[model samples]
Target chain A: MSDAEERKRAYRLAPCPAYDIEGTESWLEDMAEKGLVLSGDGFFAGVACFWKTEPRQLRYRLEAAPEGTGLWSGNGGLPAEEAVEINEAYGWKYVANRGQFHIYCTDDPSAREMHTDPDIQALALNIANKRARANMITALIYFMIFPLIHLRGGVLLTAVHMGSGLMLGGLLLVLIALGRTVARVLHLRRLRKRLSAGEAPHRKNWRRRALYHRRSRPIFIGLTIIWLGFFFQGWSNENLGGNIMPLEEFTGQIPFATLADMVPAGERAGVILFNPWIFQG
Target chain B: MPRKALSGLTESMFYVLMALCRQPMCGIEVADFVDTKTQGEVRIGPATLYTILGKFEREKYIEVIEVSGRRRTYSITAAGLGAYAREIRRLQRCLDDAASEESQLGRESRE
Candidate 1:
């Protein structure tokens, strides 16, 4: 195979900085200028696949897909067929979509901007704002419920008993996810407010923002994988009785002593009180 | 989908309904009608137009008359006509009230 044919597909961390619509569109256009065109298949596993092609300018626009279009319910990341037809007629080709953000591309410079009215665009973004708010609530509920669910030994105690590195990593992951969700919600709200005030969507400079995300994504992914590893290890240990030992076998400093330590072994001979086995880290 | 109560039409919504009242029109045709009728004062984006279309359809304010290659032509329903008529009356009343107030002020100034 020829060099270009051999290297047909290239994958990059999707340069969507928390649904910054203009930034993402600019970043995708920038990618096309670098001969890395976004593939029609779209992003998978947070990585966008691009075709290695000759450098060219492509205008990428991100349109917000409102709820109940069934696009979110596993319609293969494509917008409604009717929506696609309408966009295509206006010279914009429907590309891949990520969640509610549908990406469109056009080489035509005069593709009559996807959305002509800011007020309408704001209405579309309301869906995203609602979704973000829902996510923030969910994250908040998880943040509250998680500690209570793990309250038997407490999250920190469990960390110490199970795997400190793993538990800490998991905690960090959850905190980051929650923070991201809240940030997205706030950003969407602000954008909607601006749009409703009749302000057009601004084209933000994507270079610096894209650079920061590209640098940070790999580290974030690595940490996530490590956290996942620890999570599964802990899960297996719990179910398979791995690292479980009787209290007497535990050599670590015991905060509380059992009945055997408090009373004479002969005095407690026939009666069994509490199970003395502890799951050790 | 459960129908939402109409709480007064926005300028765009009112224009869209007005455009549909003339005859059945597709999305692009409706957009064009609104643009031309307002002499470009009011412009409806594609997303907004579709959103309004979807909403109107849900509220029984419009019905699809033709579906040719994703270009669905819609006509205003009886409910939609009623809404448009109500809005027109509402606007007329506002104009009448303003005219009356201005004439009363003129008479008071003359006195």
Candidate 2:
């Protein structure tokens, strides 16, 4: 093997937990024995082959590149359009093409391999968990904090009066939970897809997800209760006060009520007050 | 010092502390260096990477260095270096013990 090939092998062997070279190689060997020709650029592209099975699987040979060659391109190597076209021709999904290197995945064989890889699935789950956590935190901050700070009345009042803060906070928390649930559901759906298609078991961060859910559930529920109590009180006060008090009565105690009353009395009230003789006649 | 406490750290956080031992690196550069060194063994997703970096910054393990323009860089503090050294020693001791066990096992098998 050449230097590039050696590096590629090393990369392949570097405990991805995503792709299983041994299993993939065995599958490839079986296919080759049954008359599939496996060929590709060892350094840039790892493996490639065409299968003659019932469904007809297309495979791309892959090898890890150290300086980051074709398997995962960086910038300035192959034209993106050309790389995409090539990937399509070989039935590969274009992942990314940067710095002349191109990465692609195949729905047929590549998907199968990926489905069987524990590491890749774990990575995906990790990504999803991270996203869910971030969104949850953001929702907590925005819904819980923003309204508490800058509402018309005040944080506590808004929580009690308008219930806007609580409502908004509840909405945010629910949305975040929903988002996390959606992510988990999607992850499960992917797992199901792989399983139905006869793929191996993949690693999942169920423990972490469970822990996160456990930690967040109480906090979310507590916040909801607190905010809801405040919001309802505010809304009730606003409602009762609105129904009971007329605008005139409501404004009477206002500091600027006299100023408003003086505006519509025709001639300048201020002038008349300053010079009583002018209006006395 | 505590396994439970360390367990709370994400893998990137652990790597970030390791990276900081050499020198402080800005978020982007630290991420890039990790990717390069690991040769893609660890691919830090953008959001996770930034969030962890922010936490570290908040904790004072790393401090912002340059904020000239849109780009901000960070470097490890003295405290961060000390923490990194401690972690390295811990790992080294574990490796040494493991190696010794393997050697003893080999001798026993030969006998």
Candidate 3:
């Protein structure tokens, strides 16, 4: 075979290591700052400049062998053909000479053709918008519904003895609204980044991910209000009996002949019974 | 078989399939054939080409035939041929419509 053909064959046989471009660039830059030399043109083809001499031998080894043959098993090395294929798919041109391979990329009409397709652009946009909306709705539900359920179950109540459930519920709503607004702003920022980069918006769980973060806000606010109510009501005090001994003695002496007698006669019944000592004094 | 017609395939897919249709080739050969045929108009990146090839393999449109030392060779399957035929018919309709439109525009311009 001619020298060119021989080189081409060797290049085709070499294993190409794929690297994420941004990752590789950052890593190389850091290494360069540390006086390390890394060399290669394309994303996957670049090897650390320090390891330039034995590129093949220096390739990182896989912990476990791949399913296929033992050939090209260890190391980040990829077969030349595979490397060329990856480069081509990424709109790169491969030039093989002797034992060396170089990858080149230029503005090609095909790249423009693919990018300018109206259908593809529309599809990408649609996917991103859907993801953003899904996140927003999820955040809203999470912050609102969970607290309401807890309040209904009597597991959470605002203010000891105040019994103003409505006021507490309103405060919960305000907290949730504020939380949702903050979440929306953050989500919009992320969505903008994805759109600008021409990347699809990622949704962890279209249904749950957005809602999960917001749902906790109401629960947290409800818990806080309930705790504050208890704190002010002196529930945490160990000496409630000592603080109102006379009132407690009078209530304890009252005998309920029927279930009806045990029921409060009016809205003022609790206050009248619980604070009788102050009236007597 | 004379290369199955490439009608419905994406331009890159069609060329890759066509390249492998003749003989089992590794990823590089298919990419090179595409570049050669398109006269450097369509360049397939190595990553994109392999990803598509992996999809083709998963869909049973292509299969690995052999591993000659370090070089792996892939051949098109029956389904691949069917896909190529479908793609060709799709392209034919598209071409015919384009031709008719061009002719109508030409006549209009002349008049």
Model number with the top TM-score: 1
Location of the lowest summed lDDT over 10 successive residues in candidate 1 chain A: A272-281
Candidate 3 lDDT tens digits, A183-268: 54454455446545656321122233324433554455567676456534443332354335554467554554754465567645
Poorly placed runs, candidate 1 (over 4 Å): A1-6, A14-18, A68-74, A135-168, A245-281, B1-8, B35-43, B65-69, B90-111
What is the docking quality class of candidate 3? Answer: incorrect
For model 1, how big is the CA root-mean-square deviation?
A: 6.8
Q: Across residues B20-89, which tens digit of lDDT does each residue of candidate 3 receive?
A: 8888888878877887988988866444465557657766789999876545689999999888777788
Cα deviation at A63, candidate 1, in Å, is 1.0
After superposing candidate 3 on the true structure, give the runs of residues whose Cα lies further than 4 Å from its correct spot. Answer: A1-281, B1-8
What shift in Å separates residue B81 of candidate 2 from its native position after superposition? 1.2
| Better by TM-score, candidate 2 or 1 | 1
> Per-prediction TM-score, please?
0.76, 0.34, 0.37
Q: What lDDT score goes with residue A153 in model 3? A: 45
What TM-score quantifies how close candidate 3 is to the native fold? 0.37
Q: What is the TM-score of chain A in candidate 2?
A: 0.30
- Top lDDT prediction, candidate number: 1
Question: Model 1, B1-111: lDDT tens per residue?
Answer: 663586778788999999999999988899889879999788776666777787788789999998897779899999999999999999999999999999999999999
Candidate with maximal DockQ: 1
